[model samples]
Target: MSTKQKRFIPADGLAGLKQNFTKDALSGFLVFLLAMPLSLGIAKASGFPMIFGLVTAIVGGVVVSFIMGSRLSIKGPAAGLIVIASGSVIAMGDGEIGWHLALGVVVVASLLQILFGVFKLGKLADFFPSAAIHGMLAAIGIIIMTKQLHLVLGINPSELKGKEPLELLGMLPSSIMHENAHLAEIGLACLLIMILMSFVKHEKIKKIPAPLIVLAVAIPLGFALHIKTDGEIAGFALVKIGSISEAFKNGLINVDFSGITTHTGIFIQYVILYSLIGSLESLLTAKAVDGMDPFKRKTDYDKDLIGVGIGNTICGILGGLPMISEVARSSANIGYGARTRWANFFHGLFLLIAVLVGVQFIEMIPNVALAAMLIFVGFRLAHPKQILHTLYIGREQLIVFLVTILITISTDLLMGVGSGILLELIINLVNGASLKNTFKTNITLVEEGENYTLNVKDDLVFSNLLGFKKKFQAIPQGKYITINVSEANIVDHSSIVTMNGLVEEYKDGGGKVLVLGFENHRQLSKDPTSTRILKLS
Candidate 1:
């Protein structure tokens, strides 16, 4: 008789470290190379001293890794949080004072994040529609690109300061015309390298991180172009990493809490943004990394939120940018064969070492090179494919996505996301979803031995998804479960996607799940996860 082969699962905690030390260390080193430049870029973009970025990353990896719920995710400062971080700094003040004030905001927000996990509200991330989240990210991407493009073209920071994203975009042509020749040459060269690296398919070559290659090429080019000389470029052109040792010697308690009293309204606003958005992004990244794990491990979202919150609190106290379970670095860690959380620890250890001992080498890096890297990152976030994919899902989804992006760019992230959610509700009503069931669960469960049947009689939409999930969770595992959405007035894209995930989870736990009632419904689009509404007789 043939038998199914068993899959090996790695041990957790100390055994995991001992068993997978070599693989984890190697992957951690590779991810360190990727994180170094990106951390600096994200920090500078957020209006903080670049060295603080490394500080945040170091804490994310070395500290959060142990406490985090996900085994494979690499925690660190991320490009996704740049917009909010920068906004906090700008809103609080502008320069050194602004940075310290923003740190205060981060501290309060991180405490709230801890409370969120304590309350087990990590699933609240699911409350945001998928299209809206994508749109929010795309909007942040555009903002990043617009702000960094001027730097990439070697425009003086003084001239670019205080200009809005759209206004800066309008000044791009003029900025290019007045660009510093030597700085622009290096920046453009690095930008070209970043763009070309994406098209490289050679297996061995691809294994080398792109950021390392950018640094290799840009450093020499900087020297050759005399970028450091007063004749060729301004003093601000080169990165000012400063002395990590000196900063540590001064003290870690650098945050300014006075902003809470002086800028009460703005302080509360930023606190909400930092905690809400940071938790959402970290949870989503953890979920994505879980899907990518070869061992099929799952993350405890609440624990992960607590870990991230702790890390952010530390970063804020030390005057560093808030951190998250960064998606790109986490994905790269998986690709590099990281088997445990130690990979994250090693990455942070390496960054700590670099800042402490390699300050001179880091100072040689050009600000424009970092700007080039960020611009490329921004381009990926707002890429055309995101729009195309959303449209392929459904026209209504496209509307929500576009509206989210537009509002995010025109106003702020909070308002933009709120608008998207509101618009989706309106669309749901237009499509015949009943108002009475919009925010409440209307499900009944029947038990028959090992078999359970769930009858959903209300609209299955994002607004009521949390309640629906709660009811689903009450069902015992390792049983046959049937979900009858046939009576549901409308089953949205979000609910459908969530249901699909629940089915997979149940099956993984030795239970069988069968979904019924979609046969009489009309799909909003050809995509399998698209929303469905009952067809007219």
Candidate 2:
């Protein structure tokens, strides 16, 4: 994008502000309305107090929106980052220090992200295959689905905290079987509202954020039905906002940083995981948002990375949750007819205004309503058919997808991604040398008394040296190996080093090895005085 195109703030101040104010304000308000329930839920999932989620949402809307270069992206505590933040909090304090240290960690992580952007490392996303990305996301959806089932039923699944996710999945039905009436009613209400909103077809209805509608209904129903009748429902009972003051008060949290270095490995682990996941999620959201731009604005990924990094750094410092480019809010902004980044700023202002104004009445909303919204989000993410469709693309791609999904769900994100990359490298290596244009490449397997020739034409470099090493290693227990690089244009130092290593390995294996090329080639060795073909007898 050119300078004029990338410019978000119009040169004309007052006039530009006026031209955008109303439309941006409406878009911002709509996004804020959509974000409220989600922000709170994801915060809770992240092991933070409900109020922390709101603070992050507010900061993301107000602070990050102002600085972010990407138009129409909504920033908040994403479900994706909950794993990192939760792990960070657990490792940092476990009730020892304040929340300040956690803030410091966020700042450090964000700085790393900003540096990644500065260095133009956004292209790293291309290294991972598309199938793996899909599989990773699919696994996340499954995790969310399993976790939220308890929320949907109005029971504290965390009560069974030590239980495995699969075990908890089996335990949900029995909990519902002996459920409290209030819990059952709230659960059913959330599910019903979610279903209706998700499946119902109407132009107007589709535009309205379903979660807001659920809240509007659930709050009034809670008051009318007095779901809290006869005191606590169980050993633990439902909590209603007693007053705006209390709701705000319960949200204040502390962070601790002293032990962070003591747990330096854990800290780095969280930072790396958060940076990787946050980048992928944000990039995907940015791409989708760009597709929706009416003026066809394309986002600069590097610029977005820096913007989000700044947002997250500030969020960590201020006790707000880590922020990312959220698709939920981004799509909502687009659907609401937002034209520019101003829409994001206005949305933040709307959230601030809503909290200030709605405080007195905000306590009336029910948890089940928010749970319903999450259930909806989870369903949208867990597209089971996607797996089958991906499989149709290729058998190898299917294996990659399945392996990634299973590993991610069973182990962790990093392991799954690493496994996928390793699998891809192995597959590519097995396919043998394929050359295009004037380049000629050949690999021949030899056994018994047969002779094998590995040929190459055109530029030969360090990477291709690995192939040579593999071919040399394949020499039979009592067979000779020959490498023909006579037609090569060039060989890097690394390639020569590799050949020397191979020659030693081959001789140690009691196999004969020969290299036929370097005798007449210039720049073939580190020392100009040597011109003999590197050979092992």
Candidate 3:
């Protein structure tokens, strides 16, 4: 008889700390190096005092780590939320009062996130089509790039203020022409470092985070060029992190809620954006990190939502920007061999200590360096491969993706996503999906001894995925199972991906599974996960 080796799961809480303290602490320190500059950049781009970004990171790391369900994700301010945060700040008023009013919106949105978790609505993230989500992210990337490019070229902030994304993009040529030579030199150098580091295939060198390298080069260059005391370089060129301890002294009382009454419409708009988008991004990041975990551990997403909500609530009260399970830092944490949530805690603790004692060093970081880093981030999000991959999936998917990006760039995030969903629905119906069953699942389960079968009879699409997943997961583990989708009018990319995941889950639990019914269907593209529709023959 052959014996199967069991997988080792890491301990949790204090025991986990005792077991993996050295490894976790090292990962935390590395993540801290990466997070510090990115957090400052995200905060600056979001129109809040840069120091508040660290505040959000501290709360996310120190407090949320203990409560969050994911073991390895690093929570902090993310580039993804910059658009909504900046918009809220601008819509509320514009300056000190604007930030205060925006804090009120963050509080309400975070409360709603808590409600979402309490009600077990994290599954709602599954309802969004994969293409639409990618489109939304790509749109965000484009927006980030457009707004930050001028900064990278050393254009004056006063000239770029109040300009829309398209307008900013249009001004790029002019900005480049009139760019400050010395500041641009630092920015371009930092951007070059980011680009080069990304292609580093050597494992040890790759482990050194790119942001740290950017800082290493930019800080010295800033001093050599005399950015702080120079007459030519603008005062805003260097980052002003300010005093974190002093900020917190009055931060607790800084939140203003009068915007709820004064700008009622905008208040509601931002609340929806902050809660819905933030929750979606966090859940998605946690899921991605789960896939990357060495032990194949799954996150309790509802619990994670609650934890992140608590973090956001605290950050709001302290006048900080919204936070999420930031993908880059979290990935870096895993890469550095983080063993438990303690890695997140240590990262936050280190940030707290640095701000308390190392404020001067942080303040030396130039704004253009941070902008260069963000521009690199934006490039990754909007990379051409994303578009090519979507096209490789299916022309319909490409259309939906492009539509979402165009509408988002021309209008706003909510409208762009809404339009993408609507267009996807129309495409499904035209492909023979029944409108009545669009959000309803029709899978009949049959059990015989230890053998089980699922007969899918309706369109299997993203809108109805949650119900299908619930039904699929209800089956007893370690049994022989078969799924027949022959009768489904259409099987979308989202449904195909979910079914693949469920099959893996079943197999991992020592169950034998078979999937049938694709024989008479026509795949929309060469991709294995592309949508399928019944052949008309």
Model 3 TM-score is 0.98
Candidate 2 Cα deviation (angstroms), residue 423: 2.3
Expressed as tens digits, the lDDT of each residue in 461-517 for candidate 1 is: 998899889878899999989999888889999899888887887788779999999
Taken over the whole model, the C-alpha lDDT of each candidate is: 0.90, 0.65, 0.92
- Give candidate 1 misplaced runs (Cα > 4 Å): 1-5
For every model shown, the clashing-pair count is 0, 9, 0
Clashing pairs in 3: none
Report the poorest 10 consecutive residues by lDDT, candidate 2. 528-537
Model 1 residue 154 distance off true place after TM-score fit, in angstroms? 1.0
> TM-score for all predictions?
0.98, 0.74, 0.98
Quote the positional error of residue 470 for candidate 1 in Å.
1.5
Cα lDDT for residue 293, model 3? 89
Model 2: per-residue lDDT, tens digit, 1-537? 796775554322346458777777788888888887788777665656566577677777777665665777887878766656765666666322424556667777789889878997664554455567777777677666676677666665446554444676788787777665675576578678878877878877888887777777777777666764536443223423233355445354343455456778867777777788788788778867876776555577788888889878766755667888888789889889777777777777776666667655565666666666666676666677776666555455567778987897777778887787666445433432223411222445444465666665544433344445556656665457677777655543334544665565556556777877776465422343222232332
Best candidate according to lDDT: 3
Superior candidate under TM-score, 2 versus 3: 3
